[model samples]
Target chain A: MADIILNPYYMQIASFILINIILGISIYITLSTGLLSLGSAGFMSIGAYTSALVTMKLGFPMPLGIVSGAMVAALAGILVGIPTLRLSGVYLAIATLGFGEVIRVWFNNLEITRGALGIPGIPQMGREITGSLREFGITPDMLGLRANQFSALILFFILLILVILTVWFFVRLQRSRIGRAYAAIKADEEAAEAMGINTTYYKVLAFAQGALVAGFAGALYAHTTSFINPGDFSYHRAVEILIFAVFGGSEVIWGPIFGAAFLTLMPEVLRGLADYRFMIYGVLLIVMMAFRPQGIIDYQVLDWLKKKVKRNKSASPLDKQKGGDA
Target chain B: MKKWMKVVGLIVSVMLLLSVVACGSQGTSGEGGEQSGETESGEKVAKIGVISYLTGDGAAYGEAITSGFEMARDELNEKHKGELKIELVIEDSAGKRDQALNAAQKLINSDNVLAILGPTLSSEMFVVGPEANAAGVPIMGTSNTAKGIPEIGDYVFRNSIPESLAIPAALKKAVDEFGIQKVAIIYGSDDDFTVSGYEVMKKAAEDLGLEILTTEEYATGDTDFSAQLTNIQAAEPDAILASSLYKEGGLIVDQARKMGLDVPFVGGNGFNSPQFINQAGEAANNLVVASPWFPERDDAQVKEFVAKFEEKYGKQPDQFAAQAYDALYIMAQAILDAGTVTDRDAVRDALANIKDFDGVTGDFSFDEIGDPVMEPVVLIVKDGKFVEFK
Candidate 1:
């Protein structure tokens, strides 16, 4: 198990899982607020292209590229959300889907994005982290590692930190007033509106937030993979992000994260199956849906776990008495 | 609830066990072959990674590549007579970039393959090439032909002739023989291969002093070319030049012919597949394409390769298969020249130093940038098949 965990191939898979988790969370934010937006991939493309151009063409630092990418995607989200948020349900999904297609086509024909040849050899973020570490008098050779290996380790920790911070932000949002407004909007929009809530404002806000997260993920993805293309943000990719959210149970913040991680790792684990892996993946999804329609990690499971923990805490004194008797 | 949970847990455990057993069986089978080869040779087995799109949109090309690699593998083993056994660890990318990356990583880190062949598409090569190069693993692209591919790194190489070399050959033929003064150009704007092919064709046409009367663009997988064809027909160019894969190129030919535009259609390497002729049927006639391989070539190596490939795969080998076959042989010859399979740098150096490798494809040699320096043939579709044009 230690060997498997330490394998560089597995480490790469873990990085992919982390990236997908970020993408899943990006979509989950909007889904939680009663909006089924299919624009995450578009936002991701915007972010990826923006950051890639910034770093590659403008010679900006990677950090600045990411911030600018996220900001641009947020601005695009607002522009798209203002009009589309008026529609509800499938209508809104179709609009966003169209928006995603538009972005894909626009990038496909654009001159700066290289017209489908894709921009390659973007600078690696690992080098930046290692450079900073070197300034602190911590050299990679001191730890008996190559520079790239040390870079990868630093990258993994950076992703870990990002994941924790994003999850914490989501948790805080879930307990806040805006989160309640979103829940109310999801539960009964008409009622929420009757109770003096501005449904459109909250919905657009949710969309912009999702776009910001997706853009941030995309910026990181461009730097990590060191390549960006229009095909990477097609409608199929949007559907994949949606699947991650839906399959994981979008009711909770962690559901999409779990879904993305499990799905990302599942194919790698089933590599032995060869050509049958995808077929088996489809079958497993069907079986999972049949058995647990809510998702692999639904709200009910969380509630059950919470109740079990409470029960265990309350039974500790009685368990001590029982231990004395034994 | 508890009963359901237990049932789910049991099923999950069974699946996990099955997968574990599957992996064990696979490993043992591979080791079994290696052991026999090693006992006879008294030398360590050389493992090579072959990544291709075995399923999905690009499966046809992938399957052909795999067949070519397998043929090369079997022939090399027989020739060496166990003196230098080669084992191929093939992985399917399913025509997706992420899958290609995963397969490349697994090949480099876990399987410890000496060299990697193919991620099939230019776009995929863009992603996996850098990763492999970074890891110091040599990769030979069997069919990647876009610009700047060989420039990825020193570790990257490709046997397939890029459009830059192939396009001018075919275009010059069309211009000289037919006195083609003006032509219509159509290409898939979304694809790297087609887009690059278009760029090459545009440059070649301009250099040849041939006027480009019209230019049309379509996305891949679009079956309808009436709008583009109609627009082209109005221009009344002497011939049509298309830069696309077999699927879309065939559609364009059929649609162009149906619209009564019977001019000769010139294409690039993407039309070298038999499927293009099969798809367009009678309309496939008069379609000229530049290719690095022609299976019907009256050469001893070509005849033997075609016979073996057809006998094994029960189909005529295309250019993709031909290039892949040569790629495997090139790698094998390089390893033999280097005289070491375990040292990746030695193998890479030997590959870079390879010259005058006569194979099914014309004489193969890598230039300084690791791009192949080989002659491309001009082929025209005649009576539902590709034949060498005089």
Candidate 2:
């Protein structure tokens, strides 16, 4: 029990932190644009299997395999997004959810994807393809640090930084012309379109960007877990991510991130209520929706805090002037 | 306050309290030997944790595993009169890795189970393994057959076979003993069980210097294999090894015969279900697989168990059932050997020390890792039932 909080075995779940974080941020990206996409899990599977296959079959380097996996997922995202650009709100969610299922079933039936009996010993990049290369007769240097603790944490922060950077870019985008176009489109698509804004192009870009994050996250996920199967990317998972987005608050950049972390840790927190965990989860979700629809905190709090600080600083100057005049 | 808000607050508080109680399974009964918690010393009363995929895709197989464990508990309790007490705490896993982890944790933390059995999928075990190990509890996966030790470090045990041993041995028997050549390989690609089968089968074929006529894949729940059969026939393989779980395996064999591919198909432990032939009807005959335990494996203990299972269930015990019965008995044996119900480390070591502990599956021995050494049964499908073959 003492070691339950941190065990070498926990490295798997911890490594997955990057996956959830990336997924959360990706969902955040879509939520920021006043759109929601539930197809990240599907895109992840595409990336995971594609990356895993290339690494295992072609014996490619780990980085290339992961990148290829992301590229493949991104490509599929664009392909799906091109035709579904006009759809939004629940319709978009449904379309993306269906799209995910179709992709899952396709992977399930495909000869290379291996159907139900998923591929085993999936050549987890760190597990098989390492610096040692003993099997390849090219022992450059073994990834001799036995436990993947450092790498797992490192990968997590690296992904966290990427999410931060993406958000920073999103912040910039929200202030830019394209960002204005998106805001206008979100406020009213027809009104923005009347003003000559290309809603379809911006919407497509939003879908593609969301998918790129999902794909990149998926690649990282494949390498970290070293295994992937059709089961991992079921439609239910996509819905779960959507829940994360909605629960955390759809309108904020950090909403999805919080949602992902909250849900991931929720099971553990609710461990005492073992039998009724899911029931409680449902009730809690309804409660949150009915009450705190804006989430635990919103971005306006930041602005309020910023203004309060500025007011105090400016008040100091006025006080000094008043004292000198007296 | 809004009536809904109060209701929500009450619900949240109750949920929090329940969780606290659940995690309280870690509560030790002090030096009193747990006498305070029971109804009475003479009254039969003990709690056991049963973790499984009771509600997900693995539910069908997981149900069998739990029932098997329950069956053993019933027998033990009834046989010992009221002196031996037992209660089963059954938890459903959604088959997600995280769900498995939570279920297992709740079982250990809240239920105060002496030991847990199941979580039939390898992926679940991979995720839940560490927590069980950290908590110093024993978790036995009755049906997962993936390679390598569980992610829970080393405290976990599985009464299953890995592909590295089972697949090659079965294929060799097909080629060398049966004099079969030019085999076709059809398996599920998306599952680790089936995909591992492909890699092992391919390697074994290449090593044995046997030629593969064609290789094929099937999707889960896809009943038709006529397309794969067409490709198989074109190559003219003498035999086929269709690696899939029971549902699709049965259909593949049935469809193969319907399509006129009469070659004898070898299967893995995935073939060890009575439903396979029952579902396929007469088409199931002549199909063979490397089973974990043979009905006629010449083990008297297994024979006795099967006699009872047959009488009770009105069906022959499949490999999963047999493995389940044996897994519980072996776990109980480890507990008794450890001589203390409270210490998890002692029980784990006692489990590790198991050697030649005979049960239905064969001698239950543990290597450094907690994998049981069970006999591999090669059975041929005959008249919609498995027949043990040399």
Candidate 3:
């Protein structure tokens, strides 16, 4: 178990899965509210560059860098969301898609970002912490960590905690007043406004929260990869985030998580396919969608399963009562 | 319920099918391992990983690179029979940074390759280089020519001459031949390679005391160049200096010629390809470019390599193939010189100390920074073919 946990390759993949889950859920938040904003990658880039610059150029700690990164992305979200959230469905997707391209070009033109050359050698997260731990005579090898695994393990734990926190927040938000407002707005914006739901405010709020979560994922990604460039966050990536939500079934929180993990791992598992892996991946997605258009874990399926279990429990008691009467 | 069960059954069956396919490949790989193990009992095996864009925009370059390396491996293995063997584990990066990073990790941690070659593009290199450096594995790039590549770490090395070196040579040749007093610059600003190449050309032109005309920038994949070309034509410089990939570079030249602003074009390394000539058609004539590999060179090694590559691949090897061929030789020679195939530090040291090594790419050596120090040959397009510039 220790060996498996400390395996660098698995740890790396797991860390990436966690990050993708965050991205998946981030887009899921907007999807649930009937908003098809394809700007998560833009938000991610803002978070990655901001956090990387904060830590590397400004000499701030990783925590401060992460906070500032998420804050900045959320701020941008509020700013962009307010104006663009008025557009809905495919139009909103196109507008947000343009927003992503603008951010990419903006980073490409900035001197501080070093234009297209990008910022390389950004200090990796957990390096300092590990070093300080070593100074305290608590060496990683004593705990069975191998070369480069120590930092990877540290990153894994941090990502795990963040994923848990995000999931918890998502669950809580679904039951809150904001969540009901989101549902109402998604069902019918006109009706939601008629009910005094302030549809715009709630929509923007969901967008901002999505941005904040995506920002957190980006900051972690920048540090995990230990590098950042504008090309890393493009329109394709935004679409990929959307795919995770859609393919996993956007109706439930578990959908995106399942979708992201399965998709991310599918590539690795498909590696054995050699040259045919990508083709196979595409075919599989097409097949899955054909069969389960609502996603692998559709809300209707979950609801049916819940009702069936309840019925089975009630039927057993009824059968016992019938037997007693006989 | 029946439909739900059917979907579940289908999902499970697809996963099972995939896993079965995966296992079959794994079994084959296992057999390959044993085959190598059975050879010479205790003989050393040098495991090397190649990360290239096997299926994407950069697939052509990746294909050329991997085929070059494969040819080198076969030839080297035959030459060193019973002494040392080489095993290559190739991974496709698909031209993405994260995929390259994953490839690097798999190479370093899982396969434990002694060295790595290529993630193809410079953009991919930026992400993969640091990871290899951190993990204490040497990585060499055959096609990454951007600045600061070698500066990633001591473990990072590249034999591909940067645009900083290649551009100046071409520019100087153009300046002397055309007697140009002023030059216009154009580049794709959104890409790392073109951006770096542009900076080099701009600085080289300034250093040559040429008057700077108008500088135009365009993003990659932009089809229309009328706007940038119009500005350059208005400047009416004696020559045009461009730093862009072949697609955009070719279009710009073709457009400028159509607009009657045809003086001459001195292009960076990106314009050295046959594709550029094909893309620009007759406008490609008199275009100047510099490269370390010249297929038409009369040198015996160059002639032999070109012949063998053509025989094997049924196509003439490009600059990328020649560079990759030499890169593999350099890496293999380093492993041999290190005398311990598994010792990465020793191989890196050996690689760093390589000097005056002759290959198809001309005399090559790594400076202290691990960037190659090699002379580039300046050539001009004449009658739709590259010829040595006078």
lDDT of each: 0.86, 0.70, 0.88
Q: What is the per-residue lDDT of model 3 for residues A1-326, given as tens digits with 9 covering 90 to 100?
A: 87657666677888899999999999989988899889999999999999999998889988899889999999999999999987988999999999989999899999999888788877776555677778999887898775477877887899899899999988998999988998888898899999999887889999999999888889988888877788888888998998898788898998999999999988777775677878888888898888888888877767877998989977898877988899
For model 2, residues B1-390, the per-residue Cα lDDT tens digits are: 256456545755864775566556424221222421235555534455777776545667776677678788788767655444556677667567656655665566545667778777777666556556645677887887776645345678887776666777777777766788688889887677777677777888889888887788776678777888889988888888888888998888888888888878888767777777778888988787777777776667777888888787777776677788888777777766776556767877888888887777776677677766666766777777777766
Model 2 chain A: lowest-lDDT 10 consecutive positions: A144-153
Q: Which run of 10 residues does model 3 chain B get worst, by summed lDDT?
A: B30-39
Give the Cα error of residue B328 in candidate 3, in Å.
1.2
iRMSD, per candidate, in listed order: 2.2, 6.1, 1.6
True contacts kept of each: 0.54, 0.25, 0.57
Superposed on the true interface residues, model 3 gives a C-alpha RMSD in angstroms of 1.6
Ranking by DockQ: 3, 1, 2
Q: How closely does chain A match the true chain A in each prediction, as TM-score?
A: 0.92, 0.80, 0.92
lDDT digits (tens) for residues A214-306 of candidate 1: 999999888877877888999889998988987788889888998899888777777767777888778878877787677767766788779
Model 2 Cα lDDT, one tens digit per residue, A109-202:
7787666545544544433443234567643234433223333334445556766776687778778898788778878888989999887888
> Which predicted model would earn the best DockQ?
3
Angstrom error of the Cα, residue A114, model 2: value is 9.2
